[model samples]
Target: MKSNPSTDPPAEFLARMSALLPAAEFAAFLAAFDRPARVGLRVNTLKISVPDFISIAPFSLAPLGDWEPAGFLVTDDSRPGRHPYHDAGLYYLQEPSAMVAAALLAAAPGERVLDLAAAPGGKATHLLSRMAGPLPDAPLSALRRGLSSGGLLVANDVHGGRARLLADNLARWGAVNALVTQAEPAHLAASFGPVFDRVLIDAPCSGEGMLRRGEPVEWSAAIVAACARRQRGILAHAPQLARPGGRLLYSTCTFAPEENEAVIAAFLAGAPDFTVIEPARHAAFERGRPDWSAAPPAIADQLARAVRLWPHRFPGEGHFMALLGRDGEPGDEATRVAPFRRVPPSGEQWRLWRDFAEASLTVALPEERIHAHNDRLYLLPAAAVAVERLRIVRYGLLLGEMRPGRFQPAPDLALALRAGDATAALDLWPDDPQLAAYMSGAELLQAGADGWVLVAVAGFGLGWAKRAAGRLKNHYPRGWRRG
Candidate 1:
């Protein structure tokens, strides 16, 4: 493979890659390298069903040929990045090939699932859309129902900074049921042994499939072999993290057989109880090449079940996937693990906030949902276990409604609450002249004394506020205030 003169190729990268595969295979990899850099995303089911999303989207929605429900061959567009819908979380921007990995996991609502290496929230949000069900037809009715029960999607990232992005994305999408966690794979597996109904290991790989985006990678047998070793450790321990009878979907964006079929074959050999299910029956996903028998004769048959997504063949990035199912039940008679404690605020403190909240905002904070954590009060859902045992990455996880009695909608709720008759909201932004003045840490003027005003920037709602005395107190958090 010639190193293109335009790119500053890494040392021996081309030479190394050529030694690992035939010239024809190297050419195919190069041809897939021509497309643009960004990945695509489809709207989730919970926010909008596939059929409905297609009806509204200004693109021709077709079967990604290899992917299932809602997956599509999105026409390349520069607008999604700038569109309001994208900002409103109407759709997710994801790698077209990456979509296949999540769909293959086949998780559903009311089921417990874990995204072992979730960060920047691509797969986790896709899974969240599945749990939130669909919006109702009766305008305000569906809006209210959507918030009533945001299902659980425990999105975790090992790094602390990335977990914040994961939480931010989930919140931006209004999938409030999602809880963020920062933990190692081993710790998570130990805490919730065999409890996850579905687990997605979009495992870290050699980035062979990402050459186009990251610049051409110099592939070599030794590098591929090393990646295979790392893949094996994660794959071997992945089953222990899944509930007995649960599903584990392993995927990577690279084309190394060492990291793809060989890793699965090695694990299955040692763990006899798990079986490789046919991908065709589940989602009619495209299958990997069946010609590797001559090279890896021992695992030739098992390789037939693995799925591959090549950039040349599919509309997205290149990827490899295999679905494995565990045998036996998930075990019996297990007690719930109490990981979080909800200590209520003191009576005097609660009364002060409660009275202030009742008089100032349109969204009512219920006593049951309101709990003190790390010295801060948050209104969360009853089933939000992801909060327990995990550091509070983002609070106000569950969005509430503006019940009468001095309540107002949150900025996110404003878009959601817009479906119903909401009182006029104040247009403000982080740097709004009014906001800047208010942030001088002083209250600004309100037109009326004790009335509701939507706190906004431009036209987007941030939260709510009230007018008292001659000052407009910023209801936005002191912690959340612009530093």
Candidate 2:
């Protein structure tokens, strides 16, 4: 058979895959590689509803079935990431298959959750949105209360740069209760032993799924073996982070059985305290092939409960998922951190922020929640974990920094604020020329009083501006400025 020239999966790889999948199914899988890759975006319920987003969305979208309620398949050629809605944190552009892990983790409204390998924060943000419930309608105070009292989320990445990226994404998602940490898996496991109610490990894997992006996949045996070994090490440390009876979700974008079924089989054998849970059934989701697993019949039977999303069967690249439950009574909760002493802002710092908030914000943020570190001010969630040992990128929502006597709101604070939350807002239409100018960091004339102003598009806050002498000085971060 002539392999697809565009998306070259190694011929040897294809031959190996052929033995794993049935003859007809294997042919369909190859044909799927020739078709254009499908694109999807998941609505950020922390900011807007799926229905509300659909009403205002410029692109045409199709529902993504019952499995992913907030997910939509974009049929239009609109670049969603370039839109103002994206700047406002309304949605996330993610692959359809990548959305499954968090949904299957099924985190509840008040549970401590951890994304052990979180970076670039797709699953971490999704987990937070699920835990916080729907947004806009859910009052900010209630959201804060739920996050602090119910539980908090900790997103960790091994790489420092990616950990910063994860913090940025969570900040945009308005996850005030989230902690972004950079640490080795074993060290984190030691510090937070059996503390999380739910843990997700989207382990690093060989890029077999990269074929969907028209990227050539190197499926050599050596690469597959290396990925499997790394995945096993990650899995070894991940379960220790989940409390007794808590759930652990393992996922990867590769189709290799060594990285998928075999890893799970080995983990199950070593950790008899954990048992496999059947994946949520979906028409597009197929069960793991026990025949592909080299484990004994009993272990393979348990592995069959794992789910596989094949490109041929679904509108996404291939993925593998296994859900496991730690065995024990469900009451093994971790010790909650006592409330930390919040250092009040200095007299001048307090005056500047107070005057700004009173003038520009309609909502009253609690004084107790505000914490001052150096010249920067942070709005902490209801609770915070100890960060003495971890490389913490962001502790909570950064309200902004104080410059001399002046107070400046951060871009993160701007995205986190709702239109209604701000008293002095410059609301712009999606197509309004001023919106582009604002995003581009161009100064503009304003009729409002001289002070800080919220720049908004379609009632969603985009960033900040300072009005003086009838001119609005753009306060949009230079790093985020559009060319």
Candidate 3:
């Protein structure tokens, strides 16, 4: 006799899920676990339009419908992640369900935004692009101009390593108005103090929704409970960083009610200033089950406004989201930019950078935005405030570093620059051997001026090159070199 498929999951988890979902729906959900996982990507609107990407894209893509305008379901074996377009920050490979939270946040241009647990930068990048409006049609000279003139995005992660990765992705995506930080929630709450127009907590969860990814997780009641407790703690500090009348978006990839509805219910009880708002719903999205929470009917009914994405009903993995609006008038607190202390370069130091910028850059970088910390130089956003206490990995756009005498451009500066921003550049096609050589950290035979040159692929900046004698010396970061 064949074994029962229902028993594939731990009996306790199955029982809990059965109690939460309708009998037929629970069975369908279980069957969905056996099906192949869906592959999806969100077009980086900062670089290419949805229609333009579709026209030039090598793979076949089916629209993910109105739920997400930029999201698409991959229908072919083409590895877009490995493509040169990815290096150019043309798109981001993300789970279809995970894309819902940022869209629900509905971040408008010029709003102060924060991705509390942002790492690997899927949602953070999405938020950045949304704030910047449509960059595909914008001129190259206007590329640095993002959504709001004073709007800023602070992407934070607790882990240092992930924080670095977050900075890398945002840099590639050309988020000029972003700041990357690694800090605890309590610390952020203390420093920011209810200042953000929108705060997103894609909270840490028990990975219940990612089972189809082929990773084995030892699911137990204790693990689920622990995750719920941690999520509540994170949510507790979220409101402190959100301005009154601003919005806070809470999301998780777990199916456990403890981590989803229960946490939200508890938060609603404690934070009277914040109220749950109904997210834009679709037929594919199910309302949060009030009965599943331990709260009273009145409170539980409020939780119903939250949205849930089930793998069985939708072509994506499980996800839960609740958008909460803080009550009050829009105050100056929401618009106050951080007061970042400037570290101006000395006369000698300024000369080196000025010479390089004059020679290589077509656009002039404002002196106020440029700062020098020791040997490294950075270009902060115009609205950047002081973050003296936070563990910031990257304060702003890293312009480059000062060596013994000459100024060396950072890879981040190259990636952040538009095609028209660089006066001297070596443009190569994706298939060009020289492109491979530059990416692999090999010397390029291309001759140019005896100074810095932007190495570009398909009009998108890849990295930097220093030309001297007769050839271009590859300046791509060794850590990012393609093997």
Best by TM-score: 3
Score every model by TM-score: 0.76, 0.94, 0.95
lDDT, candidates in the order shown: 0.62, 0.82, 0.84
Query: Could you tell which candidate, 1 or 3, scores higher by TM-score?
Result: 3
Q: TM-score for model 2?
A: 0.94
Please write out the lDDT profile of model 1 over residues 1-483, one tens digit for every residue: 344665533445546546655899767756656656544767755454566656656554456554455666556554565444454455787887788777777777676778877888888878766665555663322134345654455677878999888877776665555567787777776666666778888877877777766565666667778888987887777766777788888888887667787788788778777777776533335676546323355456767888987666666766889888888776651125444456676665465556655544455545776666544555554455533345556554533332334233344443333322334455654335776554344466766656555554434344456566645666654544544
Error of 1 at 406 (Å): 13
Please tell me which predicted candidate would have the highest lDDT against the true structure.
Answer: 3
| Candidate 2 segments whose C-alpha is farther than 4 A from its true place | 1-7, 135-150, 216-219, 330-348
Candidate 3 — number of clashing residue pairs?
7
lDDT of 1 at 205: 80
Q: How many clashing pairs does model 1 include?
A: 13
- Candidate 2 C-alpha lDDT tens digits along 1-483: 346576677777778788887888888988887788888899988777777888899999987779889988999888888988887788988889999999899998778788988999999989988887655555452224333444578899999999999988887787777778899888888777777889999999987876667776666879999999999999998667888878999999988899999999999889989888997798888898778878987788888899999888888889999999998755524655445456789889999899878888876777877889888888776656555467777767788899876788887887777777787889999899999999899998889788888888887778899989989999998988899
Displacement of the residue 378 alpha carbon in candidate 2, Å: 1.7
Global local distance difference test of model 2: 0.82
